[model samples]
Target: MAVLPGAEPFRHEGGEVGVLLCHGFTGSPQSLRPWADRLAAQGLTVSLPLLPGHGTRWEDMNLTGWPDWYAEVDRELRALGERCSRVFVAGLSMGGALALRLAARHGDAVAGVVVVNPANKVHGAAAHALPVIRHLVPSTKGIASDIALPDATELGYDRVPLHAAYSLRVFLRMVDGELPQVTQPLLLLRSPQDHVVPPADAARVLARVSSTDVTEILLEQSYHVATLDHDADRIFTESLAFIGRLAPHAGKEGTATVG
Candidate 1:
């Protein structure tokens, strides 16, 4: 079910703990690069992969659906399992929804999940009233100017594809339905002033997930894209601590829950 045809498995040369980083919608692996590097420097092998149909022409992204994106992350999770004693999965925005799905499905294989500004539901009444009709209407195009990324970072697609947004709505529904099954240790981080995903959406996930070990951190200075914002380093630091807490004991190394 892998999305990438003939793509080889990801291998880590070192590190007993592995982290898989998933980016947001219309976003490339670049959004997670800085966070991945930080984890790698901490001796954890990290994989920040380009989702299917992403990091290319925007039209390609419009062609793919959420299932394809999930398949891609599932494959990476499998590869990470192959290389480490413990694995943690995390994502940003739509990536957060994907991360939650991974934890729900791979409850045994996954050590934990860190979700940053996970978009689970659109709160606006207008968006809710005409969900289908809105997809037919085009919105003004432009990525946020204060995305808080270095000039070299891939900000996002300038033009928001209607079909792509519709696809995300479908995925959010998928995540919402599966939230109760996500019982793994979870860290939910949200930007209070997020313009894209309402903070209440994050609260909904926190409220529904069955996990008892859940921590919610509010980013005062960041926007929706917390991975690249002012609080990004805090995310990395907190996530590292979360992973460390779940790591297998040295004497109990190689002990992991199997699906």
Candidate 2:
């Protein structure tokens, strides 16, 4: 499949500390480019891979599923692990779910995890119909670009592919069941006004994860896409701080300054 402009994956080799960033479902790496760049500028090796079936069209995504997306990120995480002494994974929305799966599966290989409005469970009765509805309909309205910035936009599909969404629900359930296996340091950033993911999702994760070191930061100014919203700077700076605290040697070179 032909990759879209500005939607390509990103890689930066800076130091021995590696960070793998995963973009949300239906959204391309463009959505997290700024965040990746900020991390790279701070002298951390970073890899932001474009999930399969994304950065193209909604019709294409219908042919793909969650397993395909997970495989892509997992491959990148392994590669990063081999190259860096310490590795951290960060993601937004569905990407966050993928990150959690990586941490659960890889264990100590992943030093820490950072997520923004991570989605774990689908709420309401509508979720129950997805298995059948996906076969009847092609897609629904999309849930991308839920940002507070008036002019900011997330590069993503305009519609949500039913088949793919069904796969996402299945993936969520699996991840939720494995949450107790995730024991790495965790930094969760949630937006109070998010319209896409409910707060209960975050609550469920905090309740289920076995991680002893966990921090939750509420974003009062942003929406679902907090990484690209009004509180983007906070997300960036706080993430650097989080990484620094977990792996101080990575931040010892110089202080990260956001312009």
Candidate 3:
């Protein structure tokens, strides 16, 4: 399949530390390309993979579900671990849920985690209907480009595949329960006025996670897609600092690294 214009996966080889960046559901690596580039500029190897069934059409995404999406990032993390002495996983929204899962499943292999407007639990009345509605309705309006900036746009499907969304809900439930197993350092960035994910989702993560080092930042000017919004630089800068703090010696001069 031909990938969309800005939706290609991104990879950068830098120092001995690696950072895995994951895009949200229905969103391509385009959403995190700037983030990936910024980290690469800091001399950190980065991997921003386009999730399975994403970076293409909505109907195509409807055929694949959360397992396929999670598998893509999971594989990327293992590859990074083999090359870099230390690795950190981060993402936006559903991608954040996936990052948490990685930290949970991989344990000490993941040095830290950074999540922006992560969705850990599905809520609202409409969400409850997802299980049944997906069978009747193939898709609905998209939930992308929720930026506070007037002209900012996130590269994602115009429609939200109901089947994929239902699977996301199920996937989040599993992540929520697995939160207690995530013991790595965590950095959570949240948008106060996010329309898609409520404040409660971020709260739940803080309450459930076992990480002793947890930091939360409020993006007052951005919305759900904070990565492409007004506070984008803030997310990028803070995340780099988080990684540096966790892996201080990994980026020193003469450190060896692999692809």
RMSD of each: 5.5, 2.2, 2.2
TM-score between model 3 and native: 0.96
Q: Write the per-residue lDDT of candidate 1 for residues 21-99, one digit (tens) a residue.
A: 8888877666776787677666676777778767665666667878889999999999989887888899998889999
For each candidate, the alpha-carbon lDDT, in order, equals 0.76, 0.91, 0.91
156-226 per-residue lDDT for model 2 (tens digits)? 99999989989999999999999999999999999999999999999999999999999999999999998
Task: Order the candidate numbers by lDDT, best to worst.
Answer: 2, 3, 1
Model 3: which residue pairs collide?
Answer: none
lDDT (tens digit, per residue) of candidate 3 on 11-35: 8888889999989989999898888
Each prediction's TM-score versus the true structure: 0.84, 0.96, 0.96
Residue pair clashes in candidate 1: none
Candidate 2: segments with Cα more than 4 A from true spot:
251-259
